[model samples]
Target: MQIFGITSQELFGQLLLGLINGSFYAVLSLGLAVIFGLLNIINFSHGALYMLGAFLALLGLNHLGMNYWVALLVAPAVVGVLGVLVERLMLRHLYKLDHLYGLLLTFGLALVAEGSMRYFFGISGETYPVPEALQGGADLGFMFMPLYRGWVVVASLTVCFGTWYLIERTPLGATLRAATERPQLVQALGINVPVLVTATYAVGVALAGFAGVLAAPVVQVNPLMGSNLIIVVFAVVVIGGMGSILGSIVTGIALGIVEGLTKVIYPEASGVVIFVIMIVVLLVRPAGLFGKQA
Candidate 1:
């Protein structure tokens, strides 16, 4: 039972791996989409914030005696609060400036965050043990599946769609959209537009934190973790279309699978496949797959 000169088990296994990777992609890109869509910030610091979340989880477990479940909640909340401070103190002042200014600021912030973490923790990675309940694997006929990997996919999808629903279907979402488009008009209606903006940024960064926590057990928790993945995430966001929530989610997952398949078919091409797709998409649809043409 082989297809494309590979055994069924091998193919299925790679697919599963791809799906797990896709899960991370979806969550990270969702955060990027949220920030760019709502606040128009490039958020180059997103990867750093993600690394912060993982470190918070690690530190909380080591110093505060917190568990994975607790860290899942607490890490994101702490990061979200930090995000609020960043927004109120820094990002708010740049709202009227060129997008490049915001990008540069966040990029510098990312470098600072990474540098501080590296200085304190060193570049070596640390392992985070999987939670007790999810520490095993299940036999899935074709392959053995790790419970944690399955959880990552399920959890990522839930968060991604839940976010989409929140921002697309609810009255709150409508208000948010209105505020972004016409802050003065929404303010006339007694909405605290600035607060909303700040909160939105917090939520965006919090999503990144949440993703980091989820990824901690699966990958080596290191200071350089975020920097390594952020470029790919940005590629996902662009391929999905800048500021398109659903686009980011779908494109991230799809590209992950594509990358995985490429690994099986041509190992050398796997790393650059997403970039190639991005190039093709850009040439064809400058607005992205889901973006509206301006």
Candidate 2:
């Protein structure tokens, strides 16, 4: 059957691909939202950290004979620890300075991280093999769905909603939110706000790291991997609202589907469609679709 001059298969295929891409966007943007909402810092190094996570997985697999499952857990933990160090040794010092300072520092850090990886690994990309269990596809009547892609969507959604619930539903989340709005009050209440801030940053970047591992098999594991997607991910966060968890999740998936459909309808316009939507959203709702008015 044909609809709008496109075969049903082609349409569904693009939708599936878009959903896979959207999964990554949702996870990455959720991390960005968490950091910005809590730390009030623009972590330009997020992409670099994501790259590092994939690299760690690659290294672990090659050097230590680790499997995909091991790397899935280890890579994120390692990156989260590194995040803790960065938060304590560097980011904390600049908390009182302008937000621009944090941005510049992180941007520089991203460059250094990417450059170092490029130096060691070279610009050419490497591929991480899919886990044996997820190597096949399933016939879903409308389309053949790759098991790994389905897993990506499921995993990303779980993490996104889990994080959202943690922040928006739980007492710990309540404290975290309270700390952002009234750090002094939260601190006076006997909470170690600095430690909490550091932990929050670690968790945020760890999400990036987790996404990296998920993506290692889907895309080339190159130093520039994170750099390539960071801008779009940032756009996702902005459109979702700067610090709105639900906003990020919804916008990421919606834009991903929009981009996918555009590729089918007009290949040339697909690349710019999200940015165009972003511009329109900015003009209509300067705070973003879900962002609060300042």
Candidate 3:
């Protein structure tokens, strides 16, 4: 006797799992979109930066007795400041050149970051304890879902949409968008476009760092964690179209659900299904579902 006459626990479980994945995707893709749209760089270091955030949070918890809530806020600040330093010292210089150089530089940064972490940590992976407040489960009629997952879904949605509001409806956002499209003109209007650029990059990286804090309990906190998710995230970004925050958020969550459903119905194809859709979308809609058409 199913709730609506159609009941499959395995499928339901997969969806719950997918939604959790979606939360990560939403936050990560949002970060990617923020950097791409505002800073005009691929930010290949994004994944590594995320891992760094997770590691930082772990360090905070273990060494400094910092709570997850505190680490969530602080890690982003720390990572974001580093992002500012990178932009100020290196990324800012490549703005006038072809976008490829920025991409390559970020890729190099990713490699360096991953390598350094691997050297220090040896890739065994570390565990992050779940916050005590979220260590329970809710029993639905059909299945039991973890409370932590529900927390993740709610918190992630809030952050994603909150960011959307901040960037789309606010006066500060107008300056940011204007800065991205016409720095010279915006600068003429008395907004420090370069400062805004630096701030934007910092903010984007901070978002990634925040995501890492949220994800620490779910995934292994290893140096390789960032590289692992970055590929799928890039696919999400590609399908959603770069520089589109809403698109990324929607696509990431929707695709996660689709992937969840596929895993229940077609187990073997689950891994590559998103990529397959991506290829098909590329052929059918070169600019992607939300990208601007030529």
Candidate 4:
């Protein structure tokens, strides 16, 4: 039962946890890649939107007497609408300006959201109870797998692949890509490029919201939650290449597993390992593992 100096059960457990983290990373990065690749905008507020999603879920449970199922359905729609408003009111004006303007605007938005939440909810996190349905563990020979965690992995991957297929393999995805690369031409062809852009941004942020709902039961639903993970997600985006959707998914999962292994072998390095990997990737292939050369 020993693998290296660790028990197989322990090793597998770490790997499973890593995979769960990777699932979140993959989904979040996928959303980032979609926004940046198509909209040419850096969504610094994505993490905040994610926080909002979890909070919204909490609000539903506390005030609305909604269950987890209802929160899962309502939270993303609410956040996605908020994203549309942000796009229409603010992001649209900045598209003609430098990308930095978009970054600054979203970064400021992130700050405002975090600050507001901190003021209202304080720095401490609100606990979200796992649904009765997913509240137990299953033995998997090597290790006992938490049902919620397994659900997270499966749900995340399903969403990731579904998004990828939508963007990479569908006609609507083709239209969106065309709009991104040749907006004037797409517009001339009678497609509403502006509307498409707004929709894309909404979809991107909605993804963050979806991830937040998935994560609410696992982690403390604090305002700083998204801020803390966004940096790592950005690193994942860089490592996977912003241009490649598949790259982001694969890289995120791989790094998560690597981080998990690091936790077992060298606990101190767990925190910094992803960043170090990012550094190495940049030095070797500046475009990223899946990014094309500029």
Best by TM-score: 1
User: What value does the lDDT take at residue 69 in candidate 2?
Assistant: 94
- Cα lDDT tens digits for candidate 4, 20-96: 99999998998899899888888899899999999999989999899998898899999989999999999999887
Candidate 1 Cα errors over 4 Å, as ranges:
none
Residues 163-230, model 2: lDDT tens digits: 99999999999999888789999999899998889889999999999999999999999999999999
lDDT of 2 at 267: 85
* lDDT assessment of candidate 3: 0.90
Task: Name the regions of candidate 3 deviating beyond 4 angstroms.
Answer: 1-7
Which candidate tops lDDT?
Answer: 1
TM-score of each model, in listed order: 0.99, 0.98, 0.96, 0.98
Quickly count the clashes in candidate 2: 0
For candidate 1, the per-residue lDDT at 271 reads 92
Q: Distance from true position, residue 254, model 3, in Å?
A: 0.7
- Scored by lDDT, model 4 comes in at 0.93
Better of 2 and 3 by TM-score: 2
Candidate order by decreasing TM-score: 1, 2, 4, 3
* Candidate 2 TM-score, true structure as reference: 0.98
Which of the predicted structures, 1 or 2, would earn the higher TM-score when compared with the native? 1
Alpha carbon lDDT of each predicted model: 0.94, 0.93, 0.90, 0.93
